[model samples]
Target: MMGGNLTGTVRLTRLALRRDRIQLPLWILGTTVLSSTSYTAVREQFPTEADRVTALRTAVDAPAILMLRNAPTGTSDGDMMAFQILAFLAVLAGFMSTLAVVRHTRQNEETGRSELIGSMVVGRHASLTAAMIVTAGANLVLAALLALALIGNGLPAAGSVAFGLGVGAAGLTFAAIAAVAAQVSQGARAANGIAAAAIGAAYLVRGLGDAFGEVQPDGYTMTSAWPSWLSPIGWTTLVQPFAGNRWAVLVLPAVFFAALLGTAFALADRRDIGMGMLAARPGPARAAAGLLSPLGLAWRLQRGTLFGWAVAIGLFGVTIGSLAGTVEDAFAGNEGAARTIRELGGGGALSDAFFTAMLAMVGAMAAGYVVQAMLRLRSEEAGGRVEPVLATATGRLRWLGGHLVVAAFGAVALLLLAGVSAGLVAGLGNGDLGDRLVDLGAAALVQAAPALIMIGYVVLLFGLAPRLTVALAWLGYAVSLVFGQLGELLNLPQAVRDVSPFSHVPALPSADVTATPLVLLGVVAVALGAAGLILFRRRDLAL
Candidate 1:
């Protein structure tokens, strides 16, 4: 412990809680509500044993539902319900934990608050200790809420507890992972990015395991290639909450937490505050020609992110493509489900409906791509990186427009891939090979305008409140996400549903595709972009 002037830690703790109280509730409550709502609705709709059997038969064959929900094969309907809901909740907890950890630790250190406190009587690792304690407490609350919500929704106590523990473990695991990331990054955003990448990897690994969990032969289940076992998320899913009630599986994330956190604290003891074990390389003595313009500077900042989105969305498309055939099999022999799928697919066929949903999911992901590009406005301005650019010859509109180019074009790139792949897979499954690519590609392109609306919101926030811009943009997106997938199950307020841009997109495949929402979103985006540039040009840089 530094044990110098120990006064500020309590005050800082209070301030941090005050700042995060609303945010913490939103993350936790949104997760709980989403999970419980889905559980309750599914349970109600499929109350009879026969209902579960039919639903499982339908879902097990439908690859879209299978991939998204990660429904366990050959399990009870109740077990399938747990599987569908818990996977989503685990992800919510993991990401929220990372956000909380980075917000308190690395962000504090990056903003110089830790230096002021290091001069105080606090222990050397007091900030790290505080962050862990606060996050751990939040996780306990989440675990308790999850347990209560599930049990209250009429799930058995033991299975509910197992579900809660699995989620809590995921939160703790990512918190420890974030701690290590915080120790090695100089800035909050970089630390967050690294930690988030770990979370994304965990999901991919877990999803792989779930996807690979097919049973074979004389009573032994075939294991996924070892990649699944290595992921904490994968371990969480394997808990088998209802069927086996495998509570012991919770130990894995705890062991991971102990090891990761110990290493992080040991690393903390070795490095000075604000400096990582790995030092950053120095930048060039002079700027590159592209780096000299406001547009150039914006591109420099966003290039890494754009590249990442491109890869991620393309992969997402590929994943959906691979699953199309599996889904075709799931809805087999279930005439009602099959017809529903086809009608949704337009007057085409059942395969078309499934293709439309797959494309819609990818379209939503591309929206995510656009949001990242939009959020660049806040990052550049907040880092004081955009200041020098603004002091130069570049107009604010040109600066804003540069990033918008990536958002618009990058979304197109993502969706174009999605449409082509969806068509390819659907055609292969149904032997309608010729028109698949072009039709699906056109469907995916129609989704871009609505997705870009989120980008507009981010830019408007940056123009209005540069500091709160990122927070508000992310909060809005999170809310939209909660409403989008879970809306029907949750019985969410109509106003809430209306807030999401995705609400406007036609449920193609079955519903008539329309140009109204797409046109409206495009007009809104342009208006917001113009407003942001106008306001940014007039404001003084806080620096």
Candidate 2:
């Protein structure tokens, strides 16, 4: 009976692998490249043992830096590189795994694919089992590639293997969590959201633990608070990759993965074919007046996601802003600390530079929201929901335009809220509420131009190649973040950096604001959006 439950899992896994050939390779290769590039960049930036040691000391002393990155465990080059990039890589791995699991499991059920497959000699658990297998295999591949890349970059084999294993473990843990979420949520969107929220919560918990960590007697290393132990991401860092090479820490995530996988399988056994453990609430029998139009329906679909992003972004802004006034005071008498802060955010008044850097990060994140919102078009089309809507009086252009409008306005609203949230906190802290609020608000609004460009291009992709929209849109955003934000640290040339739209956005508050770049970006956004609308109007519905 148990064997029958997993019948056809191998074939299903093969089918899944074929379906995800492009996406899996992109995620694996992108993560490997980012990790390897960071190692090279770290070596270039801190060319000597003494320079790396100084960096460790500065990082240990700075709580804000600790909250954003990993605590250093040693002063060696490999240790410093892991400290610089491990936490981020772990989060990336988590995303890669969760998306893969949810896509192959809940998404297939939502589209009736699982039901169709199940009727034809496939076992009840085959689809989910296959998803887990494919995603787990992808993570293993990612780990192997990352290890090889680091070893090729002159890092020791042991530390490189530890780094890869840590990342892979985090991915496997999240993939299991997502497997459970798929069985618990009524729909693919909710399942993905739940898993993504888990990822965000893990990152936040890890940040809290690191921020409150204790600096060691050596002054170059620190011990994270207990909260870090609760997060898989933190567990990955606890491996200490190149620092201590604590291979035993890998067991924590492995246990977590096992427990969650068991729970997922149990839940799958209990639940009905197309139902979730947490059933959806029934809507009113009568439709609301707001559901009458495309715009209203768009708002209905996007509002929940937009609200979530706003709250998250606003809280992040508030946290960073509250620290703004104290930034200068934190490193006041230490010229080395001040210089390090400058190197991180560029030369300016310490507080201004910090604010500028935070806002720039906020800006990059806002683009992600835009991508999610636009990808809903692909979801609707692929799920066969768009055909029914188009059969009505609604025109194709009008339907696409409705979602675009929400994405555009939602992007701007989020940026404004982030600006206001940060400015309000910083102003209150510094006793300059009026001036800070106005300036930071404008600075936050400035980010919208680049984010608009992201929306335009994603929509363009949706129109041009509906099948590739989801993967290509996210890949483009990742490319922008790497080049635009990390270019300086990576020693990438200006020509290469220019590929990201964000590289052109004026880094406000720290530098003088410029309008020419914003104007050009706006023009490009408009042109792309117009082209997409026209193309979408002419193209057949993907379903």
Q: What TM-score, computed on C-alpha atoms, does each candidate reach? A: 0.86, 0.96
Model 1 misplacement above 4 A: 1-12, 73-80, 215-228, 284-286, 322-347, 395-397, 420-434, 489-496, 507-512, 527-543
Candidate 2 C-alpha lDDT tens digits along 450-500: 789988998789889887787788778878888887788677889989988
Model 1: per-residue Cα lDDT over 365-466, one tens digit each: 777667766765655564566667767887778888888776777778778877776678667866775776767777788777667777777777777777
TM-score of 2: 0.96
Residue pairs of candidate 2 with colliding backbone atoms: none
> Global lDDT for candidate 1?
0.72
Q: 388 in model 2: Cα distance from truth in Å?
A: 1.7
* Predictions: Cα RMSD each: 3.8, 1.6
Candidate 1: 10-residue stretch with minimal lDDT? 215-224
- Candidate with maximal TM-score: 2
- Alpha carbon lDDT of residue 156, candidate 2? 92
